[model samples]
Target: MAPTSTAEPRPSTTAYRQARDTLVALTGQHDRAVAEFRWPEVGERFSWAIDWFDQIARGNATTALWIVEEDGSELKLSFDELATRSDQVAVWLSGLGVAKGDRVLLMLGNQVELWETMLGVFKLGAVIMPTTAALGPADLRDRVERGGARVVVANAADSAKFDEVPGDYLRVCVGEADGWHAYADAYAEQPHPFETVTASTDPLLLYFTSGTTSKPKLVEHTQVSYPVGHLSTMYWIGARPGDVHLAISSPGWAKHAWSCFFAPWIAEATIFVYNYTRFDAGRLLDQIRRAGVTTFCAPPTVWRMLIQADLSGGKGDLRELLAAGEPLNPEVITQVQHAWDLTIRDGYGQTETTLQIGNIAGEPLKPGSMGRPMPGVPVALLDPLTGELADEGEIVLDLSRHPVNLMTGYLGDEERQAEAMAGGYYHTGDVAQRDSDGYITYIGRTDDVFKASDYKVSPFELESVLIEHPAVAEAAVVPAPDPTRLAVPKAYIALAPGWEPDAETAKAILAHARGHLAPYLRVRRIEFFELPKTISGKIRRVELRDREQRAFDGGQSLSQEFRDDQFPDLKA
Candidate 1:
């Protein structure tokens, strides 16, 4: 006889659906949306993976995940498919001794198993420690030790890296690997409904910040902080139900959760992905055209590369174009606008918080501005020296409101936590200037901004001008020490295709900077070198600053560097 089976009653999502529908209805109505929206008051025993994802996924046939591989292969998973699969994985993992509060280290690429594990872990109320696949043994060891991870999920190719990482954690490999549990075995298990064991404030994720200046800090987020807080990101990206949103970010980064998972999922939209081993802007555009991606988000690096390709191929039904990871230069935005007739909105946020400010849809965009403070996010610019509110200073969030988007301090670092949460505010450590209309224009980081001839010089401001030159592809500006002025603006440039690293190319870039910038902010020194970047592709300006300091101390000039003074005719 066949095994007897009974259907389980669908989980109630009355409150969750009410809140989600409110935001979905208010799309493109910025003022009304901000004024009427309120963070849902979920009581104890709230698990987004179960309460939200699975509830909405019931009998839903809409594609939730679409992954296109480099070799023209693809994988599509509907909401119901993922829901059932994750349920099976959750039961399988639970049998493997994984339980509530366990820390599971997830280090996988953009694969179906990554999503399944994320959902399964959440179903078990386990804490997720997301690490990039690009990490080596040293980074992995630090994550395991600092994060207190008890289980590790990685691809078969990365299993060998764990040999050097000493831990008693359960090793679960996505594909076949010796002595590791096969992820394929989970699919054979009987699917079961996931029971919720999480509270609203329970720890859900631990992220190691992409260390650009110092060592990476462990950023902790609760079940609500990210899953609920990304409502602002949904608003910023203009996500809507039935829309396809493609956010060009690698897994393990906060932005991935921001758009690739929570934001789009909350909006009941399709999460589209193009998994490429190597970035080909033309190929990416072709996929976008083919997929009918409605909303798109990418870092400045990817946007710059896209403009180099022929953008005329297919617009891909793209309605909203957004840029983050760093401030979007006006020149790049202009190039895209000229090609697509759509403005690329800029947004500002960090690993420490959700979307604090952004150029939302249905708003007039200032070319270089990052738009206004997101609704429900109270922002103030405090003078770095005075610690008083100012129009142009360090950006901070008012702690009085206790915004749900902010992280719950850095884990295991009370000193840093206190410093960041001091003065009744959460200091962002970045500087910006607000106009009378309240739009914020990003300056360099608080540490990146330097003084030259008693005038403050923003490297971003200078680098923006440098990239406007035809010969330059990417540029990093740092203050080079000088005896007379203490420090001067020096540009390290990576040339565009067909441009050489010769003196002529440097001269042309310097001339362009001199023409576009003020006399005090001119690019005095030029060097043709590759900019150092973090594994997540963020430019590490701190590394370049250290190099500048060392060069100044040695009093020996690098042979590769070119100075504006070296070419007399190029100077203003």
Candidate 2:
């Protein structure tokens, strides 16, 4: 089938190219250029719609976005068509009392409706609180209430979740459903081009972080925070003009919005998404080949699974590959680089901010490092003891410099913001180790660190080592119940191919850990079990730590594979 047609306007060649190049050079090692980097200053008479989107949509008529299916079903929307469609949706939503600055919840899957609604909401200057289609009632309720959402655009299948969530917000559903606004109806309405009534500093985006240990916190971003902040993200992901880029991430998370909306658009790259019910490596590879995807990014969990598939399959039209969301293990990175002849550049950031550290296009990628700080992000490693810059400590952002990328502060919690932004810096609460070359390698969460004797241990360091072991399919390291050493580093391991949960397997892994680790960091206990992960596929160490706390609840209930006393020969 032919692609969609349009008569949309395009940005000035100079401005668009300037935006593109600025993003690419943000990660370069230039002190003067980076220090001078500031948020693109705009007036209160600001509107990304008229200033940015309309300019870009001025003369573009080709397919600006495409979503192709495995069975050859495809959907292409041109820049002009998208602009017109979004204008109509903006008009329709305005008629429904969806006013500028009003918070609206966007909860949809990879359907075309998501794009239409996102643009429509932006055009109307409505602050978007994006939710995932996978969200349950509990998650949705917190979003609507805490976010003060006035309207919600969600998939029809997820409409049932709203039943349990009490809210006075307007409910609009895509796909087939009764008593809901038909999103396609907007096409019948005339496109009423709009200019935002709000300022650039006003709230435009709000994200809820995954609360692994506590309840989720609401993170607020301004109109400029994401729109301009993603310049670094675009640079980090190595997106380019006319490049078909794919970033595999769920909707609710910040990573999705980072690449799906701002980063690719900032680069003028055609955002390509392969929508499937579940992740399939072969299917994804086929999709990548079919779409000619140049820049590909996915979480480490997806990369881990992708490597497990037959890497000997078709080498798709891939130019750049990247991994984030979790620390990419060196073994996983090495496997893909060797197989596909493509390096998986690791990146680091949080829901509260944009890309802070990443191996950008121009940099030499040191495996297992998340690269140096991006331009405009004044990053420092703060010592935990005195909160001073250190060689190895928490990754903190210096707020003294005027940077606009950070969240406006956690919603309704000035005290929390004060604490996080204390010590003249913004604490990330994630630990890292910087080498002499300034490459930052992720250690683990500050809370996840434990003590084995007097030595400090990073759970990620131990888990990374365990996952490299042939017998370990997956692993989670946390403090184990111990009598003498206070707490010992214990690993819950998942067996790889041909490995079984038996005395022989346990003995081999224990022996392997002993051989690799220092005396203070040895895996004192090993449990052969599948690891539990969060919705985003991060290992839920909080849950594991709780389990260890209860292990000593009854009589000393150590893990079945645990053997602290069995390895006497190595200790001797």
Candidate 3:
């Protein structure tokens, strides 16, 4: 894309490749890799598409992408083909006046055009603002306005959602739509040499954080922050060249880019995708086997569902398994291991950064622990009160070490940036505990942790215990007001299939929790209610906390709630 430079590989590009290869070589030696790895010095001007992708793609027939549809149709593209196709797409977009630094709102599902357009936009040095198709007019309007989107590329069916969204940005659709430029027209353009316009520090992506606590913040990532920084992610995933890496993630989210796009590509692995309207564990397992997937990653939700379904058939070709999104419950991990003889290594990161910490492949994994700090990530835990490094505290990256994986900061919000980077560290807001062996385990968010009866309570710890019960499918724990103790733990639970929301079920669940958890961490109240979640499927504990506080202030109790006192047999 960058004029097909006749010259040799740039110093920066060579450094990047060497760094990636080193990680690939050090896959099984986790400690040695972390101790020895260093971030490559990518100089001022750099374009990942032109420098990294295109260079590796030339004359290479290796599969770069593989997508399997729900209806059994499949598509495969070689690295060379994708490179040339993206070049033509870049030419066509340039023809439509889409230039460098123009912000484009990308709202498409798991389609080939999405990948093509992404690469093309990267080639042109434009910023991508990926939005989920599930968003309605209100969210779309907010993203378009806040992201300062100047162009839109979406599925034809999604074009009408923009009718109520007032904007003068250019519209392009993958399918036939009136007043929208046809995305298929890109194939009509001939591949041509293009000049690179991106700098290492230029904003390449604007991601809207899934708002679990408050309004979603617009996180801006520079070219090097993701494209180059995901070296850590690639290492964590244990992906290698020629491997087919499949990750369960929806479009428009940061994890989608982390696993589905950047990390796998960095490893020179084929990115495998399976699209299904509804999740069927049996069918998903069949696809994994059929595709010969070597590396796989999914959120904890998927892992839970898979464990509930039968896994006795066997793990097909999966060598490395990973879980992220939220902390993976130990029960889910244990069940999977019992069935497949493979452990699901949990990872930790945010929309603002790549994989900062993870249970690296072939390393000794501690159940319920997210693992050590990833290579090249300056991870530390700072005590909230003392503002110093501690064994258990808020997770932060030492800015003094210069963390390249982190975002530039919240876009257009200097105040928030200043607060986040205060005390010479980039605050992660999430709390965690580090063992003497250097393994860091996630606790909960700073806002989600609360004091009950003078003891600190982590909602994740309680929820993890609750889900271990047979009747509980999903659970969210929040602090409810108490008469004597300042607060008490209250669980909002979703019942498993065939489980009734009745006194007997609640009593059994509470008894199970009492047996597993410490007395100070007892769940005092529980309500059989569906858990609220963000569009990304993360449980919204903030909303549950608010609901509990409101009910307490009004001196009213939810009729669906069952208190420990009501279950007299629990005292036995």
Candidate 4:
């Protein structure tokens, strides 16, 4: 028997597929792809779930999603099965008063129910607010208040976090919980017809930025912005049909939607997940080998941890490797290339947009460079002071081209939006430099770049060098108050296993930095400390900077902080 869609195929679906296949055909031809690729002109009405996912899922028996748990329990859903299942879920949610354009706060782990609910919400035309379960009651309250959430779907175990959250929103839980509707009840009924009617510019997703520097901003995405914009991301990953793609990301953030949801599905590839309570590199490798994963994307932190583990066994069935979330250090790339016989391609993007730049597969890569602008992404580096194009400055997207991948704007914050989209460009707070060959190398964030004795300093440049040392596992560099130089680079080091955080380790790390870095970029002082991070695992350098400022103002010296003068050998 042939499976059928709940609704008929729309023209928008064919347009999107044609655009996607065009880019796929030019997979290895980076130059031609960039020059010829154009954004699909999706007309007014477009619903990716009903138009694209459903049309492809009809009568398709291929596995679309694969999830493996730590306890060895697994779940696999075929394309046809997922389409029918999501249709039933949409009907059930509609029965529960979930209406079009209503805001639904979805907080779930990397489970099958999460995917089902997301697709169902998309079909129902409801705006999804992806909140991390790690959020506490305080943060939840703020989201509810500011986001104007009308419904909330959460795990039963996390329901307590919302007990203090005052909202009139309907509560639905995956497991049994008092005062909450059972999510399992959605499966009790057969599928029903649910039409998806939404404009291409209709709001589909609302993501809160990980508040690394300040309060989290509400980023709004249209129906096509993510579902269609991720074509570039799919191209960067080189995902092909039937390929099992695994991306290490949580459900709450945009990266999750970037890899686990849109990009893989857009390519008609299997979205594979290996959920573990704790990160175990060996077990992850086992799953990758067992499932025969072809494409993989992970953050720089995970890559660093994986290198520490045994990689004597070669990479299994892996064709593409990628790292993002931050600029990857060159040494880590070298180590992985030596062991796995594969180079981890580096890419760059932000929560507000899809992949803007990346090392395309099958193209020659420049070491430490994040490749040229992605096809259809209007990338340009503009001078921060002059607001004109520069070889090295803040990275901005040319708004004149009407890039479809960018978010509509910051929701309800016109002043910030005006500033962000000022000068006919979208300012990405980070800065970068482009070589004559057009390969872009990431500098530090605009706020993170400082100066010492009138010479500019980039924290990432120093931290990259510090991590190359044997004793240093992770390092965060900030400006320390100095008497003569006004300010100097001070490093907070986290020692690796079998290394002690003593004076000897600090001196070794300092000397290594001096030898590798230029004189102006030398590490002046070091302290053994744990780095602070946001919930998303990004280093909270703002806190570190504040700590340094306070310590300098108090005229106090840390007992463990080592200065270059303390080690006469470093004085050279």
- Using lDDT, rank the candidates from best to worst: 3, 4, 1, 2
- Which candidate would rank higher by lDDT, 1 or 3? 3
With a 3 Å backbone cut-off (N, CA, C), the pairs that clash in candidate 3 are: none
Residue by residue across 167-227, what tens digits does model 4's lDDT show? 8999999999999999999998689645668888899999999988999999999998899
TM-score against native, each model: 0.97, 0.93, 0.98, 0.98
lDDT of 3: 0.91
> RMSD in angstroms, all models?
3.4, 3.1, 2.3, 1.9
In order, the Cα lDDT scores of the candidates are: 0.88, 0.79, 0.91, 0.91
lDDT of 4 at 379: 98
List, residue by residue over 1-572, the lDDT tens digit for candidate 1: 11111234233356656666776677667678778887777667789998888877867878999999999999999888999999999999999999999999999888899889999999999999888898999999999999999999999999999999998899999998998999999999999877788988899999999989989989999988898788788888888888899999998998888888898988888999999878999889989989999999999999988988898775769999999899999999999889999999999999888899999888888988999888778889999899899999999999998888899889999988999999999999999999999899999788999999999999998888888888888999999999999899989888899999998888888888888899999989988889999888888998988999998899878899998888877754
- Residue 422 CA error for candidate 1 (Å)? 1.0
Q: Residue-wise lDDT of candidate 2 within 283-375, one digit each (tens)?
A: 898888878999999987788778778888756889889888888889998998789888888888888899898887756878678888887
- Which regions of candidate 4 fall more than 4 Å away from where they truly are? 1-9
The positional error of residue 514 in candidate 4, measured at the CA in angstroms, is: 1.0
Best by lDDT: 3
The collision pairs in model 1 are none
